[model samples]
Target chain A: MLKNYFKIAIAVLKRRKFFTFISLFGISFTLTILMVLTAFIDKVAGDNYPDKKRDRLLYVNRIEQKGKDNMNSGTLSYYFLSHYTAMMKTPVKVAISSGFSGTNTYVNNKKIAVSYKYTNAEYWDVMDYDFTEGKPFNKQQVDNADRVVIISEDMKKQYFGDAGPVVGKYFEADNVSYRVIGVVKNVPVTSYMFFSDIYMPYTTSKADYKSKSYGGGYMGVLMAANKDDVPKMQAEYENLMKRVPVESKDFQHLYSHANTFFSSYVDTGNEGTSGVFIVVTAISIFVFIFMLLPTLNLVNINITRIMERSSEIGVRKAFGASSKTLVYQFIVENLILTLLGGIIGTILSVIVLAVINNADLIANLQLSINFTVLFIALLVCLVFGFLSGVYPAWRMSKLNVVTALKAQ
Target chain B: MIRLQNIEKVYRTDTIETLALNSVSLDVAKGEFLSIMGPSGCGKSTLLNIMGLLDVPSKGSIKIADKATENLNDKQLAQFRNKTLGFIFQSYHLINDLQVLDNVELPLLYRDTTAKERKMLATEALEKVGLANRVKHFPTQLSGGQRQRVAIARAIVGRPDIILADEPTGNLDSAMGNEIMDILINLNRNEGTTIVMVTHDENMAHKTHRLVRLFDGSQVQ
Candidate 1:
């Protein structure tokens, strides 16, 4: 019986080639755009920071007030780190780090601009950075290190040719010679911070600044304890701050992780581009709704076709086609049309996503469909098919045979 | 084998009430060939529709093959119709999108018959109508006479006990009309299939074994 229904559906669609084409085209086109947009968003969000130990890590930022100029920065001061480490009762390992600056290097007179950062020894233990060659700077090196540095793959390629070994090689930056102890893989663009070509010891930076305490300087900390203990640790750090030598007592603290930091920043409207994203999302939803109009038109066309075939329906009803059978046949026909449309739409969406991602007109953007995106598209097609078929199927099954046959 | 008792059908609008079938009652014996003849607006078609279980009677009961139709639900009535009765229409009413063979196979699609069986039955019915050569031709490609033959094939493919034809030859010329009558006569005589046809032509009415005429909403002589 099911096979018969499918055969009849195929015959009906083949008979009205133009109508079937239009309906399928409408549905597929809409689905493709929706899928691409959702995939792009998911890619940008970075899959919710998939590290299993994410909950144990804490990101620290500061809300500073200096002479009526208030700035909420994700980076904090190094002075607060020293104070928090000494005063906090919890045995949490704290790592303070800061973004790398673009430094011009003259290796054998071949000048190259490289991004580098200065951080304590604890920085290596807190974040996961893969090493391709050599080893990380140890506690002893960080304690006595004024000439040690880690070089990334790109930096190694630029300073030491492709075949040459970068480890144990000496490089000069700002007239300061430093030995590369380790070579790290180039950071992926998907990471929050893109600039980290080289990393230097915190002792080297501390000597340059000529201060045992860094005040009002760019810094960030990560807690190496369980996330559930964060609030308590944060409170203990706050109390520890009062006894430390600091210029301002009005510094505000915020606790977050790699996942929540970016999401919360977007949600709180802290990022300037949040409004743009919201507008884009709203427009995409509107486009999705507009796409549904074409599906509804197809439904209306189906209803008209069903009416024209009323006598056939009458005959079928007279021949023992129950209302359920009629309704099932109609629904199956529409679902087949929708599924076909969904496939076409998915293909089109992939092309669109590729085009958008490769256009290079949009800055720092990549769009592609993922598993989640495909699932959502399929779900949309199902909902659209069911909603569109309801009235038509009902009307088709409710047909009166006697009236129809009489007209014939 | 069919019986109608006090069948009434009323069509009501906002300001007027029209009676299409007024308390008409009749009986048809097994293997009977009956023709209903009436002028326009004479309720003959309405009576046929009511008898076919396509329309509910305003007041009355219908029995087919000795089973009461009043208690039968919509699904049961459809089952009864598909299993026990066949239909032929004046317009042929072949789905234009489908080929002649597919149109003929439609009635059997509701049954649990396999595809191969359905194809064989539909093919035999088409052959009986002398349309075997045009099985693959769509309705649009067929002549008016050919379309009606296909319709008849579709009606009989299910092997129903009774065939109800409403103006089966109305759209055909006299020659084509005669060809259709010949098929009906053959089916009745050879297969013992009861036939209830509605027509206005007296010549067509005379060919049937019994004739029931109607005027306005009531039956005459």
Candidate 2:
């Protein structure tokens, strides 16, 4: 029976070319933009590359030091991290890395700016970076301030012109000399916490790490043995935050929490709610509002289109079709139309993403419609179909049989 | 078999209440071929619609095939219609987007019949209407008489006990009209299917088992 309705729906679409084109244009155009947006968000926040164990990881990126008259909030300081994170018992590993900083280098007499970060030996174990040549600096090397660096494949190509075996060669940056110890794949800039052109040991920097300040230019990555230990780890960290005493006379209170990477990214200072729930609700509302106008337009168009088949509806009703059956048929027809539009939208998204990637609009960012994006697009299509179809179908089903027949 | 008692249908608005069907009582015997005749605006089609359960009477009780219909919900009424009644209309009312075979198989779609069985029954119906070769053709591709035949095929494909037709041949010429009347008469005599038809033609009425006349929203004869 559904097969028969599908046949009729295809025939109807073929019969009305103009309406089909208009509906397809609206649906495909709207869904194309949404698909591209989903792809980008998935690439940025999804479990990709070295952050695949995101479910079992937590981040402590912000520290708050408040006084009677002044309040300061910034990334965690190395001293604050080593003091507090060492007291937490839930985490199997805690890796601390300095915030990325920009430095200039001269390659082929042309000045190029490079972003770099200083990390400890355990940072390599925390993040599973795929190294292409050589190995990371050991704990002994970091303790000795070995002046060894690991550059991304992209930076290696830029400084060496695709030269072979430069792992032991000396590289100059910020007017300082360092021996390159390893080369790894380029991490997309979308991974805000992990993306850098080069990485070095924190001991090699001249900054003071023994300061008692509660805030500085550093972040900590916490890894739990399993996902179930994350909450316990968060609780332990929270309790430890209350125990840390303020050394400065100006500040009397200290505050921080161990949160997920996404939570830290969308940190709005709102307490008592996880950032995941807040961000998901915010995005859902945003998508709903964005789709409202197009859905209404499609509903209006569908009403007009289905109204033209009043006589056919009357015939079906007179032949023993219940109102439920008629509504189901109409909704099915609309779904077919929307799914076809989704196919076109998916193709358009692929082409658009390809253009963006090839155009080099954003460096190190390659957006593709992966499985998650495709599933989201499918869900969007179904929702669009239901939102645009239900009311019109209901209206048609309520039509008086006699009145509908007279419409012929 | 069908029965109606004090059937009343009123078309109301804020300004006026027009009586489309008055308090007219009717009874149709089993295996009876009944034709209803009246001038335009005489409530002939309204009476037929009420009997077909497509429209509710303003004040009346109806029993078709010995089952009381007033208390039946929408779903039960639809099931009763699907299992016990068939309908044909003046304009043929064929869906233009579907082929003749699909249109013929529509009533069976509401039932639990399989696709193969529906196709077989629809093919048999088309053969009965002498349009077996045109099953793949659309309604627009057929002539007016041919379209009426397709509508008849759709009506009888369900093999319902009663067939309600409102001016089934009203739009056809005399030759085509006689041909359609012959089909109805044959269905009545051979299959014993009770038929209640509303027609405007006297020549077609004379061939039925009985004729009913209406005037001014009431039965006059």
Candidate 3:
């Protein structure tokens, strides 16, 4: 019986190709745009690669010092983090690393611009960067201020022009020569916390980076045993800052909090307007608005289709079809249309995602719709089919048999 | 048997009211062949629709086979319509989307028949209608006369207690119209199936056992 209804639905849709095309275009286009947009957001704020332990980690990247007439705001000083955050009970390991700085130098008479980061040995354990060759320098090397650097796969290719045993070879950057101790995969550019062209020890630099008067230029990446301990670790770090005596008598108050990636983005310091909530609400509204017009258009098209088939409906009703059967039949027809649209949308999204990834449009913006995105698309399609299918089916079912049969 | 008592149907709009049927009492005995003749706007089709439960009379009591139907719920009405009544229309009203066999199988869908049983029953009905060779042909592929024959086949395929046809020959010429009349006569006489048809032609009206004439929403003869 349902098969017969489907046959009739297909024939009817074929009879009115223009309307079907319009509906399919609306449904597929809306779904594709939504999936692409979701992919982008996931790439930006979501965890990937070495940051896969994001849920189990917290970052202390900023500090604020307030006095009667002065206020200072910057990244927490290495001294502050080492002295206070190192003693944290909740964190299994507290790794400190410098933010990115430009290394503009000449190698083999070729000018290369590389982003460099300074790190201690614990930085390797806290983050999981995959090594292609050799290993990260040990704590002893960092303490001895040894001249060693870890370079990315692309860097090795650029310098040696081949995937090579260039590890033990020396390369000069910023007028300083260092042995290439390790080679790692070229990290995607969007991974701001870990991506870098070269990594060295903070002590290897000529300037003293650790013993600073004011807080800035360093981040304390704390690895907790479990994700649920993040809030407690943050509170304990905040409490530890209270006991640290001010080196300068002029400063009276200190403020800082360890934060996850999401909290850090939404941390307005006011605590009332959260960035995560706002972004989620905005995206929700965006998706709703995107789907609204298409859903309405599909509903109208379904109404028109049902209207054309009213005589058939009347005939069926006259032959003992109940309203339930009619409604089920129409809904099935609509579901078929919506699922077809979903398939088309998925195909289009794959092509679009592949193009974006291959074109290198956004540096390190490798995007794909995983299972979560597919599930979202399917849910959206189901909701879309229901929203667009029900009212028309209901109205068609409620129609009087006499009036329906009289319709052309 | 089918019975209607003092049936009154009124068409109401915001500003006016038109009486389509007024104080009309009707009875159709078992195995009876009845013809109702009326001019345009005389409520023949409206009365037929009411009798088939497709439309409700404003003030009337309907009883079919000793079951009072006016108070029956929608589901009950549908069940009764499916199990006890069948309909044939002026345009044949065969669903064009379905093939001849599928269209004939439509009534069975409302019953508890399985797919295999439905196919078997539908096949037998098509054979009875003399369209055994065209089981898979869509309605458009058939002639006007054949479409009406298919409509008759669908009506009787369910073994309905009664068949109500509204202008069964309204769209056909005399020859095709006579062929339809003959089918109805044969079904009534041989199978003992009650048939009530509405026609404008005097020749067709005379073929039935009893005749009714309506004018201005009332029975004149």
Chain B TM-scores of the candidates: 0.98, 0.99, 0.98
Q: Clashes in each model (backbone N, CA, C under 3 Å)?
A: 6, 0, 0
lDDT score of residue A146 within candidate 3: 96
lDDT by residue (tens digit), candidate 1, B69-173: 888876777778888889887887777766788789988887878889999999999999999999889899988999999999999999999999989999999
Global CA lDDT computed for model 2: 0.88
Q: Which rank order by TM-score, best down to worst?
A: 3, 2, 1
Cα lDDT listed for each candidate: 0.75, 0.88, 0.85
lDDT by residue for model 3 over A144-214, one digit each (tens)?
99999999887887777774588999867887898999999877766666778899987887656767565
Residue A238 local lDDT, model 2:
90
Residue A116's lDDT in candidate 2: 93
> How far off is each candidate at the interface, as Cα RMSD in Å?
2.2, 0.8, 1.0
Regarding lDDT, does 2 or 3 come out ahead?
2
Q: Provide the lowest-lDDT 10-residue window in model 3 chain A.
A: A265-274
Models ranked on DockQ: 3, 2, 1
In terms of lDDT, the poorest run of 10 residues in model 3 chain B is: B70-79
User: Which of 2 and 3 is ahead in TM-score?
Assistant: 3
Clashing pairs in 2: none
Scored by DockQ, the top model is 3
Candidate 3 lDDT: 0.85
Q: Could you tell me the lDDT of residue B36 within candidate 2? A: 95
Model 1 misplaced stretches (Cα beyond 4 Å):
A14-22, A44-52, A62-74, A89-92, A99-118, A139-164, A168-182, A193-312, A349-369, A402-408
